[model samples]
Target: MSPDADPRSAPTSPRPSGLWRTVAEIERHVATDGWGAPLRLFALVRTADALDRDPGLARRLPPNVLDEARADPDHLTSVEQEGVPAVADLDELLGQLAWPDGVDGAALVVERILVPPDAETEVRAVTAGDDEAGRARALAAHPLAEDVRIAVGVLRDGRHECAVRSRSKDSDGEVATGADLVPGLVGALAATLQD
Candidate 1:
């Protein structure tokens, strides 16, 4: 967490089922343009979401933290949300999530998963069985997530990051493809980043 942010101030309202939208957006741009643009958009939206969720942060986060988060990568250390350190780096890229490498459709492997970048930032989110868990789940059709109901914190680089990754236990935390519905998410991300 940034030194000057607050987590409790987050708005308590229904979350937007923006996965399909995000996915479609990303795919649309990538298929039409290039990866850099789509990824930039993804990062911007993702960074914005993270800030809104953690207001107590340093305020000058996006430009600074992103400098690290992008290259650092988010690693899924465990399917069990509580065990992971809040500031740990993700294990792989969304496409590298072997769990859903070949599955189909957006399915939440976990109820809701929270993805904390290695930069020690958290985007407190709620999973309604429809929310994508993280970048990986978003990429996979069956998304996973960890809402505020279950949260943990870890220390990395002397900073705190969100700790809690949700997966559909029933699905054994595997990823399914949402190629049909992903362009939205990807496209939106691309638009914001590509600029």
Candidate 2:
């Protein structure tokens, strides 16, 4: 599926579902560190399941967090993966990943430069003969290009959600949330959860 031309027009929810909440939380967490950050991957687990498997975690996690999990069966806890290697190709990186059985879902947060539909032809012409680095530079320098951080989450059961934060509209309230905001990334994350 193709992404929406204007991600800002995507749906937003005051009370998001479990997967949507997790994806939006990941996006906000990444935003705290500012831009130019590396790609981040997280394993989503049902909070109650995790606490049940290791009751000791109850002491480690905040009381409010534990309470919420107990109240909501769908609550999810995001466990970030560390020491991930930097890769030029996102698809290749995702292709190499396979989650363990305990992971109920997976999420990815990444930054990208987007050119508006009106500028697509000009963008293609500008970077036509350029190499990877040259093409990146050309796109970054494009006047109409936008910098956005996208968070996509997918469950083993096929549920998916996305949250997008454009640099220009940096506030948390302005974030756009929907299922198909980033269809390609959602598909990639789903692939990693395959058995």
Candidate 3:
């Protein structure tokens, strides 16, 4: 893909069935677009319906937590606030999880990121030679981000899909693409299931 090209605009096959497919797509986008930014992730957990049915389990959980779990047995969601620490954390994070009362299967959603310009600063640095540092500093002064949404969801059933959509931060133009920004992050997310 050209540096100016948007990966999201490229053709995508029908959504794949397993987390590994999501992992592969993330790798492909990164190879084509170059990695950009840190990724934000979310974890979705489905609490057990047995919480409501099992009086003993109900007693162990806080009333509110139990009530919420009961009210939405199939939709318990939790987010990991810290940015992905490492790819290994993907599996580790999931393994470390201890759901309240009745949580069961889990899924992951990785937020999208902006695709940065190719060598915007590096080119300037090379041209400036002895003053390379100064040139790089100038380029960093004004930063622009192309608002894009390329979120990937990996379900407990191993079903996954990457959704791409875009707009400027100011909401000016509309175009779709951004997965190029955080491929490794998405890979880590997918690894949770793959591992």
Candidate 4:
């Protein structure tokens, strides 16, 4: 999805809520840049609150977005966090993250190579003793491996949303959206909102 694409124009499954729409928007926004991008972190703030804190945003946001924010109290605006440290391990990165009171939630956009289920055993064995870089190379070279970009969002109230787009089927229409798509990633994101 292009940066200028309307968030509401994206197709979603099972009817999307405000949080889900925000997550999907983030997924599309990142997808525009194509693959091999680094991990991205976003701060999800209530749209009403964001506008209240920064009135100038009213002019920058897309048309009718501010109006929708005014109509829906649960609407969220995602602000990308820049200059994030390069971390080899996602778990370690998320474990050290702590959101402030102003942040209503957090979202993480990451690209991963997924091997077919039948190749899991062999893939693990081949990369068992390799370092992170070695494992990444091995996975990328695997014939059955598929590259996927996953965006997961979690709210302080325990709400979660996930969007997954594979390189093979890279398009706004092909994105898969659901609540429990990536439970583990959702859990890790939720931990960041913890006290």
Best by TM-score: 2
- lDDT at 106 for candidate 4? 95
Candidate 2: the clashing residue pairs are none
lDDT of 2 by residue, 16-109 (tens): 6888888988999999999999999999999999998999999999988888899889999999999888999999999999999999999989
Ranking by lDDT: 4, 2, 3, 1
Judged by lDDT relative to the true structure, which candidate is superior, 1 or 4?
Answer: 4
Which is the leading candidate under lDDT? 4
- What are the TM-scores, per candidate, against the unseen true structure? 0.18, 0.89, 0.35, 0.86
lDDT of 1 by residue, 1-195 (tens): 666768787567853233333332333333333212211112212333344456654355545465543443331111111222222222222233222221111211112234435211222232334444463444333223333111111112211111112233222123233333233333322222221
Q: What is the C-alpha lDDT of each candidate?
A: 0.29, 0.90, 0.46, 0.91
Which one wins by lDDT: 1 or 3?
A: 3
TM-score of 2: 0.89
Query: Which digits, one per residue and each the tens of the lDDT, describe model 4 over residues 1-195?
Result: 899999999887754589989999999999989899999999999989988888998999987888889888999999899999999899999999999999999999999999877676676677757566777787778898999999999999999999999999999999999999989999999999999
Off by over 4 Å in 1: 1-16, 34-48, 51-195
Worst 10 residues of 2 by lDDT: 1-10
Model 4 residue 190 distance off true place after TM-score fit, in angstroms: 0.6
lDDT of 3: 0.46
lDDT of 4: 0.91
